[model samples]
Target chain A: SQTIHQWPATLVQPVGSPLSLECTVEGTSNPNLYWYRQAAGRGLQLLFYSVGIGQISSEVPQNLSASRPQDRQFILSSKKLLLSDSGFYLCAWRTSGNTGELFFGEGSRLTVL
Target chain B: AQSVAQPEDQVNVAEGNPLTVKCTYSVSGNPYLFWYVQYPNRGLQFLLKYITGDNLVKGSYGFEAEFNKSQTSFHLKKPSALVSDSALYFCAVRDPRNKLSFGAGTTVTVRA
Candidate 1:
């Protein structure tokens, strides 16, 4: 069975502080990974997606950035955090097939102080 | 290029009653639509999807969706609502690149 893991589960960071959220998938190889953010617990906004290592496509323009160093490891980072950056971050992955449903991680909650 | 819309911000239903979450979408080609559910402070769980063939698609947790191509709508339904069914629901459309475009989401509250 495939599973996705994301961390840190919860974080409280001050403004201008650096941020890093990691996600990794197990039981799959060369899967498609994605990063999404939910603001105010409502709509989901796509942040970034990677089809393969070192290949990331950004959907929204923001201070946040994503990197896929390994086939199953994806990292989301920001040099300086802002108050508006606080939200629930979700990590998901889909098999590298024509038709595969996405699987999600537990999620990471960031509260920018 | 492909997008989805969940018009209602919230839906309230009594337990044992039918539940429906409406969704409409637009796409240039054949649509690949999906439904997901989210609990508070958790990740979105895949419920169902509509690619082709049958107009009615059944999914996890006794939930199903009807794909109406004529109306460009895919509405999630449950024969009987439960308190556990209260959560946030999202509708999505997948583009050719396999990127999913999600709707604004609708909050469902199944009262006891």
Candidate 2:
């Protein structure tokens, strides 16, 4: 059984501080990884996705960036965070060549104070 | 490009009653539809998907969805709603470009 892990479970940081959120998957290799953000407890917005190491695709232009340093390890980072950058960040994975069902992690809630 | 639309923002249902969350979608090719549930402060959980044959697809937690190609709709349904069923439901369509587009999501409240 494959499982995804994300942390820190919750964070509170001041504006302009650097941010880092990590995600990792076990029991699977070369799986597709994705980052999504949910704001105001409503809609979800795609942030980034990676098919392989050192490959990242941005869905929207924003203050955040993602990187795949190692297979099954993805990190979301920002040099300087803004107040608008606070939200619930989710990490998900799906097998390559599959239809489109994704397994999601518990998620990281960031509050930019 | 593929996109999904969840018409209702919220749905209120009594426990043990039928529950339905409406969704519609648009895609250039055959649509791949899916349903996901999210509890407060938790990540989205895959509930069901419609990739092929059957118009009705059953999934985890006794939840199912009906894929109506004619109407371009895939609605999530449950015969008996439980108080635990109260959560956020999302409808999604797979983009041919190897991504997925999610709807605005519907908040289901099952009152006991």
Off by over 4 Å in 1: none
Candidate 1 global TM-score: 0.98
Q: What share of the true interface contacts does candidate 1 keep?
A: 0.59
Count clashing residue pairs per candidate: 0, 0
Q: Compose the digit string of candidate 1's lDDT tens values, residues A72-99.
A: 9999999999999999999999988756
lDDT for each residue of candidate 2 in A78-100, tens digit (9 for 90 to 100): 99999999999999999998887
For candidate 2 chain A, the 10 contiguous residues with the lowest summed lDDT are A94-103
For model 1, the TM-score of its B chain against the native B chain is 0.99
Badly placed stretches (over 4 Å) of model 2 are none
Per-candidate interface DockQ score: 0.72, 0.87
Q: Give model 2's TM-score for chain A to 2 decimal places.
A: 0.98
Going through the candidates in order, the fraction of native interface contacts each one reproduces equals 0.59, 0.84
What TM-score results for chain B in every one of the models? 0.99, 0.98
Model 2 docking grade: high
Inter-residue clash pairs, candidate 2:
none
lDDT by residue (B1-112, candidate 2, tens digit) is 6899999999999999999999999999899899999999999999999999999999999999999989999999999999999999999988887788899999999999
